[model samples]
Target chain A: MSDVSSLEAEVAKLIVRTLTLKVDPAQIQPEEPLFGDGLGLDSIDALELSLAISQFYGHQIRSDDPDTVATFASLRSLCQSIEKHRTK
Target chain B: MTVGWLRQRERGSRIASRFMIWMALFVGRPATRALLYPICVYYLIFSKQACRAIRPYLIRALGGPISRRDLYRQYHCFASTLLDRVYLLAGQGNRFDIDIRGLDVLKDRVARGQGCILLGSHLGSFEIVRAIGLTQQDIEIKVLMYEQHTPMIRDLFRDLNPAVADAVIRTGSPNSMLRVKECLDRGGVVGILADRLLKQDQATACTFFGKLARFPAGTMWLASILKVPVILFFGLYRGGNRYEVHFELFAEEVTIDRRHRDREVQRWTQRYADRLEHHCRLAADNWFNFYDFWEEQR
Candidate 1:
């Protein structure tokens, strides 16, 4: 797998584990929406994922950040944002 | 993002809410209450979704088959409490017969300089709780809500009393939980609705009214982590300008060890579900969830 796909896979796995979604990591489409209609994730899941990503990637995910919504849009988007912002 | 029943997408017009507030101010309580009958009739005819939502709840609460009369009564009861909110929020709670039972539970906690969590549901008029906040000078009550879900209603509250609006802690804000923690640390009461799950909220499947349902575990999690008592508050509307606000202590502290966090979250969540079921059964008509609550949204 390419580096980008690998990152997406890792993030998808993290999301499934963190929110305890009743879906497989492979089912979470890289380009599909992570919230609302896509994965049906809510604000509570957003907060939980923010904490998980921050701890795993060593980067703060501020809910108030203007781009936070877009960053949480999909697995690929989240992976890219984390890569761009990760301190470790 | 897709909207769910609890999400703030299709809330009624802000203008209507504003109109009601002004009407209550001009016409007084009895006249404003007469308006609710027509409104209830309107919802009963047009809002099939709301009717569908209440059917199962009413049947379970009443412990018998529901009738058209029961359905209308449910809708009317909901409308009555909502109309009463205008008077309550306007600081005219003295006009109504509000009997607060077990307030000493809260008073004792606040006296000990220890903050507590006031967990409530969408069963009755939460504005009655706000009425309590108005009279109590010793304790500060901060309400935690998802403001974006009901902008028009929140605006109505803001228009009526900005101080109450300012005390609201919007749930999705970055510092929302931090603010709640701070309030609790200051021996201030923090009120939250423990019933509905927000979009993507982690919920534990539990039994409500003998059927499997999902209840949000966030309240239990917060109570456990904060090491504070959790109190259940229910303000039941007893038709014709009378309300009975009951405060029961659910837990002294919600203890969830890291090793068994998920298990503990589910257990305490069920406990809350139990208490909610008991109260909802006692006052069947007051429960007002306007959508299919048991559906698997996630």
Candidate 2:
């Protein structure tokens, strides 16, 4: 797997573990949507995931941020934003 | 359960709201409040939907069959609170005799410089709680409100007190929770009215007034995630400028175990419903959720 895909895999695991989703992290398609249709995650899940991301990566993902929607679009996009913004 | 309240049209026009506000401020509270009798009668005679919506809750909370007099009393109570908002928001809180109970519960949190959640319901005037802040100056209270439902009344009150509007963290916005977290981090108090269930909210069934009613779990979720103290507040209007504000410490920190998410949230939500029911019994007319609460959506 490429570096980007590896990072995506890592973030996908975080999402599953943080939310305690019954599905396996490996089952999450990298390009699939993280909310609504794909993962069936709602706003509360998004909030819990954001809190987890902030604690794990030392990055605060604010919903008010213009890129937040795009950043949370998919596992691949989430990883990209984390790469750009992660402090630690 | 269906969220019929969302589709329920906001009553009263801008002109009517403006007239009420003008009378409330200039005509004085006593004189303006007398007008509520006619207003209540008008709503009682015309607004069948509202009357229908509140009937079940009244019957349940009152613990018997209700009369037209009882319904009129409820309407008058609601109108009184609404008119009092004009005075409260305008910083004329001294006009009323407010009896505050369990203030030390809030003071403890404020003194510790730890932010806490004040979970209130539609039972009474939440504005009275903010009025406490007006006098004390120590406790900083911010309201987390769903602004979409009542734009006209909200705008009228917002105009009366822009500071109250400025302090509101509007829900449904992307960054709503983030702002709530930031406010709590600063040792500020955040108040939320948790009675009404929005369409997008995930609800947990709780026995309220001897029947299972669905309450939005969003507040509990936020509290658990934030790991903050949750305090229940009720500011009941006890007729003729007498308001009673009560505060009770609900939880030092709300925790939701991931393995038992639904169970834990349900337990907490039930606890809230129990407390809400207790307060509802205390002031049946103060209950303001004008919708078919127990009806499940198919």
Candidate 3:
């Protein structure tokens, strides 16, 4: 598989688990913003993502920060931020 | 319908609702909370049939194939939430003090010169929402409500909440649509519950609780038409004798792809559904839709 599809696959799994989304994981796009423009994730997902990431990867992300919004902007951004901070 | 049977059902259900409400309110406080506990146990649980009806949903959502004993414990939690909703709805409040997290989020939307559609669900008491929203905020909260049973019941609701009576805008009126549009044009807030299926064709079918259920597209359609922010608001009953109001700006999901309006509405509504499910997952019993939510879909 191409690099884009691999990144999307990783993002897809996290999206389904974090948001409890019902759609296909492979369907998630690489550059698509996860929140408003793409998957339409609401604030509840933001809270759940924060909790889920903290528990699984030991990365604590705050919701209020502007960077948090951009960081969680898409599959690529979220993965990069997680990779950078994740201790586990 | 037979007059006697209808009367019986109405009277019986309200009494049941009130009893649970009292239990939730009184059973929480130091002075009266303990006394109300046994009543909550007897009415909400020992009542048997009604309690059993709610079990499967709670079990499926909460315990998730847990052992028998743990399932029962989750039932108790659900029962407690129902009791609290009752309290919030039926109890007397001289001064309803509230703490709304992300209050500014909603306030910010309203502050903009465009009116908004406030989408909520059957999760908690919509009645308590008006009591808080109208009483706490200066913005006019025009709620879209289906008319209730007899004039007597209407009177009872009015007596319980005077502010809401003034604020409620009944659905199905030509005048109601005009008024809601006027509210939007003037930048007021129109509250509508998007969870119930108004009609079969009018709904957006989506997966809920691992099953496909229809959700009305009222929130998306209206917001898209008005080109205004559609926000999701939830009034959560927390551990204290107080509530934590959750105001989320979910307007980002409201899109303008006219070709796929139906699916776009469904997709956007799914986000609303997911957000709602998250809250319901947290406060399992605080909801009031006693009927089988997924029963009609099939």
Candidate 4:
């Protein structure tokens, strides 16, 4: 549980850093949406975020992959995906 | 920004398009081209919205008042390109004389095995490039476009060559960028039309033809993120089955600094608008975005 939370926190920081969002990583809710109305991240952000994830975790979050939508749903889901697929 | 083009309904019916294709293929190029005169006149008389939308552009490009003859020529130019799509897509490109300028630029990229972005506009026949690619088996062209917008024309052309259909990476899909990235990684050329902007797109106001008009910054962002070479392509149609396909190396690499992202995007888009303007002057009738392009004026 602690490991998962830490991974989530790490992903939150990554997102904030990659997007240069004004909000603090600690303030981001695990269950809050990362796109659309929630985090307000657009498609360009998604591309940039995917690149960052691939570089940092060594796993490409492909759009064709069925798990992509679920993976990008929120910080928790994204962390879970990283935990499952991260090669590094 | 007013997405007038998106709001404007697609003009022709599927049956009409299919019939036109059948006529084009059966009757052949020259005979079928004669039919465009009546069709062009029909549109010039009827398509009031298109006329109103294009007047400003024609005035800007021609540097004078828009006359009926000028409008007819514009309509005829567009209709000619549309009819030629049948020949171009059906593997009958030999019928037309294509004057390809800057083939060396594309050949050099292919030689390097470095995937690049071919940034094009709606100025002329984009399909003509695909026809050129058919001769060169080495060049793999994948187009990123909004396929949903023009389903009738898209489906008709797609059926002409299933292989070309397969090369399309439809925009607005979640995996569209992923597919583009994969294609680029494989040293494949991805063609993108950077002229028009969707409602949700991030746009930068650029000085186009001395007016501050918004152009989508997303393509530049994608190029920067993927770190690929961008080549500006304009396939201008010269009357009587001749096409001047020009390719200019726009940027070796597009880099956006995080601190000045907006300014950088505007700079790149302005450069693109400048190139597009230059080409527009070269072929005034070739300007195909038959919509109120300068939303600011509206």
User: What lDDT does each candidate get?
Assistant: 0.79, 0.85, 0.61, 0.86
Report how far residue B92 has shifted in candidate 2, in Å. 1.5
Question: How do the residues B86-113 of candidate 4 rate in per-residue lDDT, one tens digit apiece?
Answer: 8878888877788999977877886788
Off by over 4 Å in 1: A1-88, B1-4, B7-11, B133-135, B296-298
Cα lDDT tens digits, model 1, B1-298, are: 2324764255467778777878889977778888888887887888877787667778778999988889999888987887787777788887788888998888788888888999999888777886665346657788888777676777777888888887788876434665676688788989999888776467888899888887777778777757889889999999887899999998899898756778989999999889889989778888877666677333
Clashing pairs in 1: A41-B200, A42-B199, A42-B200, B8-B149
Q: Is candidate 1 or candidate 4 better by TM-score?
A: 4
> What TM-score do all the candidates reach, one by one?
0.77, 0.92, 0.60, 0.95
B5 Cα displacement, candidate 3 (Å):
17
Question: Which residue runs does candidate 2 get wrong by more than 4 Å?
Answer: A1-4, A24-33, A36-38, A63-70, A73-77, B134-138, B296-298
Q: Candidate 2: deviation at residue A45, Å?
A: 2.3
Global local distance difference test of model 3: 0.61
**Per-residue lDDT tens digits of candidate 2, residues B10-121?**
8888998899899989888878888898989999999998888888899898989999999999999999998888888898888889899998898877889889899999
Give the better candidate number (3 or 4) by DockQ. 4
Candidate 3: give the clashing pairs.
B21-B86, B21-B87, B26-B33, B27-B33, B115-B187
All candidates in order of TM-score, best leading: 4, 2, 1, 3
iRMS (Å) per candidate = 4.3, 2.5, 16.0, 1.9
Q: Provide the lowest-lDDT 10-residue window in model 1 chain B.
A: B1-10
Q: How many collisions per candidate?
A: 4, 0, 5, 0
Indicate the docking level reached by candidate 1: incorrect
Alpha carbon deviation, residue B258, candidate 3 (Å):
4.2
